[model samples]
Target: MALSDDTMRGVNLGGWLVLERYIKPSLFTVPECFDKGLHDPDVCTNDVDDAYPQDQWTLTGLFKNKDDARKYLKDHWANFVKEDDIIRIKNAGLGYVRIPVGHWIMGDISPDEPYVDGEWGDFVRVVKLCRKHGIQVWVDLHTAPGSQNGFDNSGRTLPTPTGVGWSGNPENVDRTIKAVRDIAEGIKQEGIEDVVTGFGVLNEPFKGQNEAQVKDFDDRAYRAVREVLGEGTTVYIADMFDAERFNGFWDDEEHGNTVLDSHYYHVFAQTPRGFSPRQHIAYVCEKNSRDVNACCWKGGGAGGGTSVGLKRMIGEWSVSFDTLVCTKLDDVMDSYREGGEVLEFTRKIGEKRKKFLRNFAEAQMVAWESQDTGVSVGWFYWNFKMEGGAFAEWDYLRGVEEGWMPTLKAEEKAEHVFGRCEEIIFRTDDEMDIVHEFPPSDSVAPDWQAVEADDDVVVSHGESLLTKGSRERGDGIVLGFLSLVVFLLLGLGIAKKCCVRYFGGAGGKGGYQRVGEVGGVGEVA
Candidate 1:
């Protein structure tokens, strides 16, 4: 089970094993709670709060007995995603599906916790279905004992949005590690290692608040999982939304088959608030592309690093670019209404928005899959399918149906689509001149300041104007001189040993090893 060179184009199986209110609203709708105005006094203390539940914790609390809750969730799990969905995914040419699971999947949580008894059986059945369809699986621990990010997606939504309790508690971290161990062992016992090739220890621990604790938890969880599954299985850890800081965190000799999972979403932040359709596509093609390239390149020149530079994948991203759909609010749906007008008006732009989304999706695919940038493992859309296609931007199946997203068969001929952003950026003749600008302006003309003359030193305007050109010539001369020196050393056999040591030749430290090699696990299956 060595790391595959082929890029993984996959979709996330969200809101299936894990409950997300927005993904499937029907599950959160309790008729008695809404009609009779029943509410959990512990969670809903104010009159302004909704009578309905907000997360799995409160949703399960509405059940009078454990059996009722188990039966209800089991039914939802059985019907929400089935063999037909797997068949559809296989037909679409997606080879991987990242399944998010709660910490209670193994039924190891305390009785007091407001979660279903177990969903491990259902989880296994889904994996078996994927195996039948010849698709790979990446199991993700999307929730922790306590709320990881204090969001409903983490299985709980706290009273305050930023009230994180997972990392602050040592017991909770230990429990999460045990859950990872159990999951790894479960996959082994089920004998599906060939299909379930990757495991994500935890998903999106609030990095700004729990940097040190999250790193510690990741280290512990990686060791715990490796002890059971070995290096043959790829272990993924979230970049904590800071890929630059975590790019080379696990590139040491001890760690192998490790990947950094980075999630990209343009709608959540304020930077893309006022961007036009073309600006959104340009942003992904330029800035986002550079960032992904930086994360993919580990150390030194291309192919001169150890063990195939720590792999990276865009684990979660969506086609949504609307700023109105903010996730910061306690109730995300409330942001859709503003000044007595529904925000759906923005989406009513009809064909224009659809065309923009199509181009945006293709631009993202081109930037992410470009070989000149770096070796990207692959990307997975945030969700496979929304419940009713209410939010088409976030639904991969709907995007395909609406003629925006490219199916796997379409991606096979992606060369035509890869040039889409280039056309948009250079649509006009003036736009071509802008690309050739040495120092591109950031929406403003460059300012030039003249320095005052000194008695000992003379300053000239012409020399100042040539500052950039002079520097470029100087760098070229230095590079050429160094090249000649290297050529002479190699011709004389003086730098052979040094080059071998630096580039990690055979019998050298930091050399790349295939699976089942000296530093790897058993033979690749």
Candidate 2:
């Protein structure tokens, strides 16, 4: 089933279930800080000698041993996100929350670091709480076994940061599929299927692998997820930065209802590097719109399979910039210091900063809500909150409160934008093929050709007639070879007849032998 237009606006429950150093550095207890007599004030921050021992700053590195980490999670995981947070989400007018979780929560990665007895139970509570608040939940398996992304957010990092992830090992892929099955069934058993939208099988599975490996893993993992969830359950497959691979993967008849998830982050890539604050805003809005049109709303051609059942959603996006603007804003205006008092420059930049951020944020919302691109299910802001001296641009609620993010009133405009385009899949739940107005060109037509209802034989121009299962185009080489062979044989027969007629047929040998024998009689008789 397609997600309702009203329920698309969303935010991610980051830094709560998942422990990211960039999100909440205080959560990790470093020995260097202790030596300096500094301590994190939050009691929830686990105390340990070296949580990120060996430079592995992930949730798995939170404690010295598995037991300590499990005990800490058991005691404090619930507090990280509570009923109040759900209420906050509800009040923000956002209808969905994409919760990023690790495989460890379901006990996929164990013996090394295990979740305590009731650790998995905490997830159940979160879903129930969201349901209670009339909010939908998107369960994203962010960290797969062996670390799919090899990034800290996936809860593990490699010695060398090559993005070689779970795809490198077959067993890791199987374990992740098993974990996905367990989560899908667990949610259904708890009767949260209505509230829990779908399981994001593997988040960013093959970030840097070749396309073949990515598709191979995607096919296996998707089939595994569909088997567990059954038909009609919306399964989200991350494009792994390969959107083209997902072009028509889920459009097949047998595949269940699925949504392609693409994360649109403006800060990371090099294209938007030198844009002004306003240009950055315009670029993202335009890019976001173009991506949606290409993927879902606009059909390439009739030969292009109908994209009717296809749906796409931006699973993650942020309003932050990687430009000098963000650098200037970081560290409490430390970058703005030249001659004037630092505090004065900080205040001056802060005021101007709000306007830049507000415009940037609104441009994204408008582009996302624009008639052409608004076809997306909805956009999920990168995060609900971040604890480090994190910039406010990354925080959804902070941006909203400071007039940077659009208010609920402005966000409601997306619901009406649907009318501008023809009715999309969201309006109907029927499982029918969606046809584009412009039929696909002949070159791209599906393998099967269409025939008139009354015609007994299907006639194709310069193509042979085909039976129920026959090849569409017949072989011309064999026919041409037979014609050539027959013509050559006839010419040879004619030549033989002519030679016999010209030399007096059977008597030709007697007539020519006497003349030659007279001259050579002396040599031979």
Candidate 3:
């Protein structure tokens, strides 16, 4: 079945099926591997150290054989996000869960590949458990055949921060598509297709460097999955950090039931790190709001001609303000100092960090759910929960426990949060100006009097018959009528001049007119 029209408030099941060292540090710590100094021949064949297995590929090397690797991974998968976690998710009022899976979950890993086996069964078990709890699933192929982004989360940690190889290698791209198809087929065979209503073809594929290849893979992978899952399923294509570039990618008729998945994180960039807590909330309420509205489908036209854009979802986002938390908080504090704030001022506000984080989270929720700004579908937090419950900002369960994330149950509660923020940041016109550096054109309130006047009947001669009877009107009706006539005459004159200039006139060649010319009727060509 297709995803419900209701906003998809969900959380990502990160570090479960696909391993990320940062998410679950304990899983990567293998004292035996460090002590024995043994590496997996397939992945750790390089000069790199095997002691620190940054990704799933290298982590498998720590085990003696496939059986050992399977046992270890199976244990982690079974316990990481068990039935209780699913129950907790449902109780938290979230309707969907995005489970990130490695490409090897399809059991197509070659002998040369260091990834373990039997994750497919564990993945199915998680989906079935979610089904029982009345929750939808977004199966995300987080890792591709050859690390799509060369990031550790892609299940392969490269020796260096090199560019992606998945798009460059045709076989890798094909394998990735096969993996997508396998996932769809598995869901079908397991009879969990109803709950597994969404499928993310790839997570965070670097589109900027491999636009053509990525587009081709998206088309092929989309078709491959659809061939098995049919049209009811929602196929997600990652925006790859460039949302504007792929704004209307899935709007066409051929791409029905497709969603552009975009991940939004403010902490990664320098500009956001410099923002004050209030500025961060304002940025979401204003700048991010405008961008979301621009990217989302406005619902008028058919196929690629849709009025605004494609169906979009904030596939991942979090309340985290800083990029990373090192052992010493002081090391990162200076880097994230607010713009123009002295060290003393930064430290003062640091005391009330929890309150600011709560406000920021609420602002995001309000903006993501706002019809005026949010994505057409909805949003999912970056993660359901991190390993140790240390990263509260990225962990939904921790955020709720700490009172930073709202225990959102209904739409009414969302509105209340919005109202509360409005009272603090967007309450007054001036306050609104503070939030929006460049206010949207539509932000200005319309002139009701002028709007009502527009409804008056106007003759071809530029005379208006006052619709509001003159008997009931004041003596100033003559002045109003005269003013309207004068305005119409000037407008007509300007239109005629614009026509003459464009179609050739005394001006010769009708080159162009500046804004200063013809009473500012035309722009410079």
Estimate candidate 3's alpha-carbon lDDT, on a 0 to 1 scale: 0.63
State the lDDT of candidate 2 residue by residue for 220-294, as single tens digits.
766766676666467777877645556665565455456778876655443333233433543443335455545
lDDT of 3 by residue, 1-525 (tens): 765567788999998888875566667655344423544454223332333566788788666577777876777887888899999899888989999988888789977887876877778888889989989999999988778877788888665433357888888888898899988898999999888999999998865356877878888989988899998898888876666666556656677778878776765443444344444654565455545555535343222233232577888888876443322223223322222432222121232565666667776776676554335588889888875433446778866766667877645446454443232232211111222111221333322111111111111111122212222345466746744553464445333222222212211111122112121100100
Report lDDT (CA) for all predictions.
0.64, 0.53, 0.63
| Alpha-carbon lDDT of model 1 | 0.64
- Alpha-carbon deviation at 453 in model 3, angstroms: 42
Each prediction's TM-score against the native? 0.73, 0.67, 0.71
Provide the lDDT at 425 for model 2: 10
lDDT of 3 at 115: 87
Clashing residue pairs found in predicted model 2: 301-440, 302-439, 302-440, 303-440
Worst 10 residues of 2 by lDDT: 457-466
**Per-residue lDDT of candidate 1, residues 1-525 (tens digit):** 667767788899998888886676656665434433554333332233355577888888776666667876787888888898888888777889999999988877677787875677878898999999899999999999877877788888876444258888898888899999988999999998888999999998765566777888999999988899888888888877677676556766577788888887766553343344545554565456556655634453334343343677789888776532323222434433222432232332256566667766776776666555445678888889875433557888767767777765523634344453333322211111111111112332322111111111001101111222323446566545554564466446354333322221122111112212121000100
